[model samples]
Target: MSDEQDIQARAARGWRLWLVFLLLVLIGLAISGKMLTLNMQEQAFLKRQGDARILRTAVIPAHRGVISDRNGQPLSVSAPVSTVWMNPQEFDLQNASIDRLASLLGSDRAALLSKVSRFRAKQFLYLKRQMTPAQAVQIEALDIPGVYVDREYKRFYPAAEVATHLVGFTNVDGKGQEGVELAFDDWLQGVPGKKLVMRDLLGRTVKHIRELEPMSQGQDLQLSIDLRLQYLAYRELKAAVQAHKADSAAMVVLDAHTGEVLAMVNQPSYNPNDRSNLGAGMESLRNRAVTDTFEPGSTMKPLTVAAALMSGKYQLDSVIDTSPGYIRVKGKTIRDHRNYGELDIGRIITKSSNVGVTKLALSMHEDAVRNTMQNVGLGQVPGTGFPGEQAGVLPYHAKNRLVERATMSYGYGLAVTPLQLAQAYIPFATGGLTRPVSLLKLERPEPATRVMPEAIANQVLRMMETVTQQGGTGRRAAIEGYQVAGKTGTAHKVGSSGYEDDKYVAVFAGVAPVENPEIIAVVMVDNPKGQEYYGGEVAAPVFSRVVGGALRMLNVAPDNWKPATQVVMQ
Candidate 1:
């Protein structure tokens, strides 16, 4: 602190001053850094809170459409229901929750515990798919935690077993699986929706943020099934199946002018309400009127006779001698049920003699017959705008075995479905024009193809009318009021081993109001094991009752009047 000390002291004092300034600066910097750190922490906390409150989304299911009949009577519909869902992670299987949940859900406690344990990782699981409002209310009263319900859809078929086959049914996922449900699934399914929402810590949807996508409900559909006629057909078919002890029975009724299907039914039917009894036989699933194939028997003879009349080969009154009840065709004998010594074309159809058809078939060229059959909607499935339809079997026109031709002439070689027979008969019903059958009720009329000459059609119609009269093969097929023109067919059903003797396929196909035939009905019973086996005995009587009911219901006045009874004893 003296001279060197004085200079040093001044310097030391200055140095001390500088040290103080540096200390002050350091203190200021520390204070500034602390404030910055505090501010940064506050900003981070504010951002975290905002992130927690932001919403993302939620999904909403769309509603399904309905299916109704022509008159707007619902056949199938979507029913609103509530479903209870559970989140495995949130569900408490122990404590007070277990007993409460078990009682609320009507589940055994042990089973519920086991089932819940299996869904440990699932954020969401269905406790029940469809629950009634009362059930939901009962469940809510239990105050069970971790359980919630959302609105859902379930299919309902009101007609039940009556219209099951054609209407089909939907599956658990609300998707159409079969029948009309499958066929029109594209138009019947709905689009799902998504929503942005804020969820609570407990995973409950709290606040809606933003809707992500749009959703649309499905459109309703209208089908062309006549419920009244359907019931009648079902009754007739079911009665036939029961009376004949038939393995299966089916029927189809077509409007000759419009070609609309008035009635279609099958026996051994199941209710759509319960698929538990149904199997994958594919046979029961089939609409036999439009599916399975079988020998048409003598019902096919009328086509040959029409073809003959059309080609000018024979007249309605033309004479053909049938001797010894049999006719030889290329070394094969074609025999009728009863022998007729001499007969005309009318008697040939009246008696349904195989020999008479064999003679006519021999007289005609094979090409003409083949072309004629094809023209009559044979060798092709009638396009009825439905799936799983069968085309049926048409034999080779020129069979190596001449017996084949004879058999075909008598409907033994050729095979077809009941639907095909109905369509084929349309030509005769509609005065030589063939038309497509419809399952839709529309104001627009269906277009028809010219299948035969009008003259031939009239002549054939006249001859067939005789077949339902006093001594005709289908004598039992006579309805009370209307003049009915039809043919009876009795054929052996072929089994895996061989032809079953007791099993027969009996059928009656014809048109009513014979002068201006309106309805074309084809009734078929398969593998009837009962005593009455002939088409005349089994199928004809069924046809009579069905056609009679149909005519009465339709208010069709009979050209002549009498009940179609076998033995009406008073």
Candidate 2:
């Protein structure tokens, strides 16, 4: 029995030992498997961790598109510049070298310290932007740790103040803020790229790894403006504004056949290259020709005449009595410079008779008159895609009081931008056809829509020609060698009070060479302080000078080279 007990205990001990051995082997296999897995992925994981510390992704800025005139003269261009930035965390703000860094960056020591301390938690901070090559080299030679330079493009307007109103200016970060820059931002801005690079402990790039994306330059944009014409207009408008001591002025010249803006210039212009005055009032920045509205005054008479003619109730020979030279409508008196006893339609335009125009306008239906104004693009944006374009005010049919209707006829109780006024005269220039206005160069001149009968337009054209001839209000607008047709407008400015007798917006709109119209030029001189404040005195001369030069530039042979017949009526 003792021998049996001993054998059983031995057997139990032996089985326990075998089971323990199997468990040990299984544990060893699990350890070996985990070790094998770690062997496979550990190096990659550690490499990634290290790379995260030393490798940096750098941005490569793409160049913005060039803005050019129709003649391919660059209006706005991108100049290469360097921006210095730094990792505030990696930089030692307390280091003595920071003093030199501040000096080179055009920053004081205290300001530099404050900037770095304020952005201590930030990974990146711009030290300076748009540094010249020499400026960049000076900073790089200082070799301050964690400071890095980035390449970017800065916009430079070649025409400066001459074209700044139309080309506009950009922000420090290369964003468009006004004018054409804001209008076509997406088309003008470019796509940025990135690259992975190895950096030292101090955040200085040591070696390039690979490009993550390629930068694509923006497309070039060609404007409908002819730079020569633009300069010409600017020169003339600036001279006029300064000569008259006017508050401000604007001028627009359009290709009569195509409605493409050949030149649009504004006075009191600013230099886009110099941004120190950016915070100034909007008066300096606004493209007043398209953005500002005014009571168009007599520049609106042609449309009124066209509407009267369109009604089939009037002809160029239609006569209206103006014996008193003033007429009362709705208790509001409308007057001309003088009371011409009786005037025909042609003589009315030639004399710029307010009573004559008011009588003619009253004879037509309201809808007919309003439709003519609307069809000529008044009270609506010209669809030039220009930023901040105003749709000038016009009374709705429901609100067309007799007073308002009468006032609208003689260019009151309604407002229009200079561009809109120029667009309105397009029908007269194009023989009753109105072309869509554009800022971008078209593949071809846009198709035209007939706004009035050819005969009516021709008759209006002949009347407008008489305006540049004798007895016309716009005689000053006539070029010596060419017949001109346009109306002079002298609107009493409507202020917080009813109407300021002292303030006026003098305007002239005309199409030159009555036989064959090539361009329409509109000029508006605001609040001329001199004694000569009439449109013929202030604005007409500007139109005459600008359009005359433009016609010669375009090489349009003059039909009135023989000299115009003169008829002077005060």
Error of 1 at 18 (Å): 27
Q: Name the candidate that leads on TM-score.
A: 2
Query: Number of clashes in model 1?
Result: 8
Off by over 4 Å in 1: 1-58, 103-106, 140-145, 196-211, 279-283, 561-570
* Candidate 1 C-alpha lDDT tens digits along 1-570: 357878877888999999999999999999988878767767788766766655545667787788887678888988877788877887777747667667767887898889889998887888887777678766655555567666678899998877777777888788887677877888888888987777654445668777789888988878766777788788877988887789998888888888887878887788887788788775567667776788889998898787777667888678888889987767766787878878888788999988888888878877556567788888896776666778887867664556777788778867898888888899888889987777667677677789888888888888999999998989999986679899999998888997787778999999998977878999888888787888988888888887788888878777877666698689
- List candidate 2 stretches off by more than 4 Å: 1-41, 94-96, 397-400, 563-570
lDDT of 2 by residue, 1-570 (tens): 699999999999999999999999999999998888877868688788999999989998988899999999999999999999998887876677788888989988999999989999998899899998778877877777779887888999999898888889789888889989889989999999999999886566789999999988888889999999999999999998888899999999998989999999998898898878767475799899999999989878888888898898986677889978888887878887887988888888889888888888777787777889898889988999999899999876543477777778888888999999999999998889998899888889887898889888888888888877777787888897788888889999988969998999999999987888999989999999998999989999899999999999999998877766899999
Residue pairs of candidate 1 with colliding backbone atoms: 1-5, 1-6, 2-5, 2-6, 57-196, 58-195, 481-558, 482-558
Show the lowest summed lDDT stretch of 10 residues, model 2.
Answer: 395-404
